[model samples]
Target: MTASSTTTPALAKEVALLAVLATLWGASYTFIRIGVETIPPITFIAARTLIAGGLLVAIIKMRGLSLPKDPAIWKRFFIQACINSVIPFTLIAWAEQTVNAGLATILNSTTPIFAFLLTVLITRHEAVTMRKLLGTIAGVIGISLIIGMEAFQGVGKELVAQLAIVAATISYAAAAIFGRGFKGLDPMMPAAGSMICGAVILIPVSLVVDQPWTIAPSADSLLALLGLSVFSTALAFVIYFRLIHTLGSVSTTSQAYLRVPIGVGIGVIFLGETLASTALTGLVFVVIGVAAMTFPSRKKTVPV
Candidate 1:
């Protein structure tokens, strides 16, 4: 079998993981929304990191693979935590308390746009192609369609919350780009390490601000936190890091394209919201965009 043929199956597996990642995170919006309804964002996300981080660390131990003892690796883990989990996770959690999850999903789907720009201008390591650029545009268009233009009705009303989500989107893009540095390690190491680092930072703030002992969290909120911590965070981060290793940052972030539709679909089914006709069209654009960014471009060969 040729290299191309062998590579195809592996890429397909990775892409399938990408879709799973998207689904996990897409559902996280609702989790965050429910979680922040009764729980403070700081405490909620802090617990999320702590729970997810602890779980992954236990899993790593069970596998008989210890995390690297290098301080440099830990330092990188700390940095990744700040960019990937701490900033973005907290911001999104805080934002969803006020801004609706649909708009947040729409806003958050811009990761590829920022990733595309960062890859081309700052990193310049990845190939910058017109196809990828078009893919970036198409992804945004898809998100807007999937969420429906009506989702923007509260945009100006919640300016700060909206901007918070935008900032989170930028942070996510940077995280995907920065994640390339963790290439050599097992995907779980960075996933677990970063979550631990995030928990270390956020827990103190939560203690001071939220005072977890004082609050009585509702059953819905508690369940939401568990869901977010387990499925959307711990498991999702494993898949996320794997994709970053296999698919590159920009393509991995293309999962944000998928998240919008999946998020909306979740909301529709659970919340009794109606799906619009345009949403179907948007999904088509999304598939096209993700395909453009994800699949390896065939290099035209020179016949010798």
Candidate 2:
């Protein structure tokens, strides 16, 4: 078979995986919203990580894959767990108490913009380009547009909640950069280990703050939690890592753009939510910014 012919099927599979991963993550916001109606934030996040961690462990065992035993790697896993899972999950859950899940997902799409800026300003790992700079500015403007002036008048708590989601997105950006440290390790191991570590960290907090044993969650809430853990957390990671490995970071990160429409659709259909025209416009801007930042640059050919 020709190299080009062989590459086509692989690329198609990766695209399909990307679509599925986006859908899973999009559904996560909806599930979190449903779950947090009865389950407290800390307890909900704790359950999500613990359940997902257990499932990943089972998968690893079934596949005969072993996790790394290095203490340093474990330490990194803890750090990633905090930024990637524990902190963000808690913040999003809290934010969802006030913010709509669809809008939160739209705001969260700014992750790549934050990632690019962090790489330029903090990490100095990537050179700052005009395109990326413009995209970053556009994303901020988009967020402002999403949160219209009317939302701020006597709605400080709501604004703060929305900002919490932005903070969560920033944390996600940092995690994406930090995750590069695990390049040599099995991709699944970091995801599984970070989730386990996240659960460990959140357990004490949930016990103290939430005291989940006293609460009886509704059937819908319980089902939402299950879906979040299994579909969004565990299966999504499997597809995510596969796409990252196959398509490279730029293409994989494009899922952020795809997630917006899926999230908005699910929220509108399932929750009977309505979005303002301004919010939709802002979503377009955010998607455009993310696309600009993540789309691969073309190389110019020199005439021989």
Maximum-lDDT candidate: 2
**Model 1, span 1-304: residue lDDT tens:** 8878999999999989989999998999888988999999999999999999999999899989999999999999999999999999999999988776655666776676666677888989877789988987887787667554546665454666767887898898898799888878988998899999999999999999999999999999999999999999888877777787788764776677688878877866765555457756776676667567765667799855
Mark the 10 consecutive residues where model 1 has the least summed lDDT. Answer: 148-157
Quick one: best TM-score, which candidate?
2
TM-score on alpha carbons, each prediction: 0.81, 0.96
Q: Candidate 1: where is the Cα deviation over 4 Å?
A: 1-17, 137-157, 241-254, 273-292, 299-304
Tens digit of lDDT per residue, candidate 2, span 1-304?
8877999998898898999999999999999999999999999999999999999988888989988899999999999999999999999999998888899889999999999989987899888888988888888888989886647585698888988999999999999999989989889999999999999999999999989899999999999999999999999998988887799888899999899999989999999888889889999899988888988899797865
Q: Candidate 1: TM-score?
A: 0.81
Global lDDT of each candidate? 0.83, 0.92
